[model samples]
Target chain A: MPEKVEITPESAVRAVLRDILGLDAEQVAGFDADTELFGALPELDSMAVAGLLTELEDRLDIMIEDDEVDGELFETFGNLVAFAETKAEE
Target chain B: MMLRLEEHNIGAILPDLPGTNESMQPQHAMDLDKWASALLSFSEQAENPTHVASFRGGSLVDHKIELPHWRLSPVKGRSLLRTMMRTRIAADKESGLSTSMSDLMETAHRDVLNLAGNLLNPEMIKQLDSAQPFEFSDTRTVRLESEAKEADAIVNGGPFWLRAEPSDDMDLVTAISNDLIDWVNG
Candidate 1:
C-alpha cells in the first residue's frame, strides 16, 4: 500500500481547480468544495469535464472509472475534492 | 494586492504544445506542379491560409459536390490570397519546381480534414450545401439544410466546420452533424 497523503487538502484542491478546471483566480476562489460546479461556470462543458478528469488522473494518480461519475461528483468543488481524497485513502 | 482570474494566461494554465511531410511522383507536369505548390504553402508559409483555401475546393469540389461560396472570415481569405501570391514568387525562383491551381486545392483539403483529430466532424460539407433550409440550435451540433425526405438522416456536404474537440462516439458525431446541418440549412 502507498503512504498516507499529508499535504494540505486546500492546496491540493487549489491546484486541481487551477489546472484541471482551467479556472482563473476569481473562478477558483469563487467556489469552495461545497459550491456548485455545474451550471455555475458556463465554460465547464463536456470537453472541460473530460479535460479535468484527465488532469485529476495525472495529478492525483487516481483512476476514476467512467461509471463512477454522475450528477453528484461534479455537483460542486467540494464533492470532487472529497472524491479525490477517498481515492488517496484507498 | 490580487491577481485577477480573467488575467491568467491559458498557455500558463496548460502544458506546452509540440510541432508537425514528403514528395509524390505525379503523372503530368500540372499534377507535379499542383503537388509542389501545395507542399510549399502547407510546409513553408501560411499553413492556415492553405487550410481555408480547402473551402474553395478545386478537384475535390469537382467530385464531392458544391456549395454557394460564403464569405470566410476576412482574416482567412486575406491570408489565403497572400499564400497564393507567395507560392507564385517561389515558383518563379525554382526552375524545376512549379505550382498549379489544382495543387493549391489539395493542400487546402488535407489541412482541413485534419480537424478530425480533436474535434467534431464537418460531415459531408460539400454535398450538403444544397440543403433546402434547416433550423436547429444545440450546444454540440447545428443543422444544415437537405432535400432528403423524413429529415431524419444527416447527409454530408454541409457548409460548416467543427471548431472544437468533441467526444469520440458515433452517436455524438451524428447528432452534432445533424444539428449543424439543420442550422445551416435553415
Candidate 2:
C-alpha cells in the first residue's frame, strides 16, 4: 500500500470547497488552526453544510455522528479547518 | 484564488483553470442578478404561473432558488416537479394527498424540453411551433385568467395540491414552454 502522504489542513479545506459546494478559494475567506466556520461564508447553506460533513467523513477516514454537527461548529471557514484538523490529528 | 470556473457539473466540467477577472467581481454579481430578474420577468403574465420540472442551478442557462436549494434548468425542469414528489416520499409525510397542479405552479426555473415533452413528437421537433412570440397586453392577461379558472378545476384548492399525484394540462403546459422559449431567445 502507498504510504500516507503529508496533507495540510489548508489544502484539504480547499479541495473540499471546490469539489463539493462548487465554491472556490476566494469565495472561502480566511483560514486558521483555530477559527469559526458557520459565520464566515455567507453563501454556506444547509446543503453545503451537509456536503462538508460528508466530505470530511470520507476524506479523513473518520466517522462523525450526526449529533456532532451543529451551526456553531461551522460559523466560519477557519472553524471548518480546525474541525478537520482535530480529525486529522486524532 | 480560484473563483469562477467555466463548468456546469461533473459532466460539463472543463479544465481546472483559475480564471482571473478583476473587472468581473462586481460585474459578475450584477450579471447574476440581471439573469435572475430576466428569467423571472420573461413571462409577461405572472398570473399564468410558471412551473419548473427539474432544477440543477446553472450559471448561464439556469438559476438557483436558495430557499430549497433547487437549480432550475431549462431541459431538466420536469425533474423539479419530480423532486417535489420525491421529497414527499422522503419525509414519509403522506395523508390525504389532495393537490391541484395550480398550487404547485410557483415561479421556478425550468428545462425547455420538458415543458412540451409529452406533447411534442421527437420526429417533428424542428417543425413544431416553438419560437412563437407572446403578446402580453391586458387582454392577453385576461385570456390567461380565464384559462387558469378552467385549469383550476383539476386542482382541489391551495393545500389541495399536496394530496394528489401530478397531471398534465395544455394551458399551464403552454405557459411553461412558451416562457422558456422566450427566455432562450431573449
Candidate 3:
C-alpha cells in the first residue's frame, strides 16, 4: 500500500488558485504574502471565486460555510492561505 | 484524445448526449434516465468491442453502458450541480440580485432553472442531487494526485476542467492516453 501524502493548506490554496484562475506554476509561485488577489487578478472574478472556494474545500477536505466567505478573505494571497490554514486546524 | 487513441488503433465516437452540445433535445426536458439510455443505445450501434471512458458528471450515466469503464476523476452529480449553482449565485450577486442555494433549489423544484448557462428542470435537478457513480467490478477509477478520493490509479495533473479558459496540457493528455492504453490492452 502507498503512504498517503500530506497536503498543506498553503499548497492547497496555491493549487486552487492555479486551477481556478488558469495560472501556471511560476505565476502562482511569484505570489507573495502581500500579493493582492480579488481585485488585482482580473481572472479571479465572481464565477471563478465560486469555483476556487469549491476547489479549496475539496482539496483541503474542509467545509466552508457561505457566511465564512467575504471579500477580505480574498483580499490578498496571505489572507486566503491563512484562512485555509485556520480551516485545516478546525 | 482521439488522435492518441487512433495511434493505438482505437476508434472513438464522441456522441452528443440528449440535450447537450449539438443534440436537438431541449435541455430542460432531459433526465438522467434519458441520458443513460442514450448512451446504451449509442453503444449498441458499435461494431467493435467498446470501452466506456467517462469524466466528471458523465460517470453517473456511463454505468448504463455495460462495458469495462475507465473513469478519469469522476465526480458525483451533486458536486457538479453544486458548482453550477454556486456559479449562478455568484453571477446573480454580480448583477445586484442576492440569491442563496436554498432559493435556487426552491426555484428549480418549481420550474425550469437557468443555472450558470444551462437550463435544467426540477426532475433533472432532483436526480442530479442524489446521483452517484455505479459500483461495478469492471470499473477502473482514476483521480488526480491532488485529490484524496479513493481511486484505482492516481495521476499527476492540474484540474484543467476548472480553468477559466480552454487550455491544453499535453503532458497531462499523454499521461492519460498512456494510462488508458494500458488499461485497454492489459
Provide C-alpha RMSD values for all models, in order: 23.3, 22.7, 2.0
Q: Write the per-residue lDDT of candidate 2 for residues B41-82, one digit (tens) a residue.
A: 543333343332222223222232211111121112232333
Residues B1-186 of candidate 3 have per-residue lDDT tens digits of 879999998888888888988878888899887899988988998776568898888899887777899989887787778788889989889889989888889899999999888899999899999998897887988878767567787888887899888888898898888889898888
> What is the alpha-carbon interface RMSD for each candidate?
22.9, 22.9, 2.3
Off by over 4 Å in 1: A1-10, B1-186
Docking class of 3: medium
The candidate that wins on lDDT is 3
Candidate 3 wrongly placed segments (more than 4 Å): A1-4, A30-32
Tell me the DockQ of each model, to 2 decimals. 0.01, 0.01, 0.51
Worst 10 residues of 3 chain A by lDDT: A1-10
In model 2, the runs with Cα more than 4 Å from the true position are A1-6, A29-40, B1-186
Clashes of 2: 33
lDDT of 1 by residue, B39-148 (tens): 44443443222111111222122111122222111112222232333334244335465544345345544443221132111232222222222112221111222111
Docking class of 1: incorrect
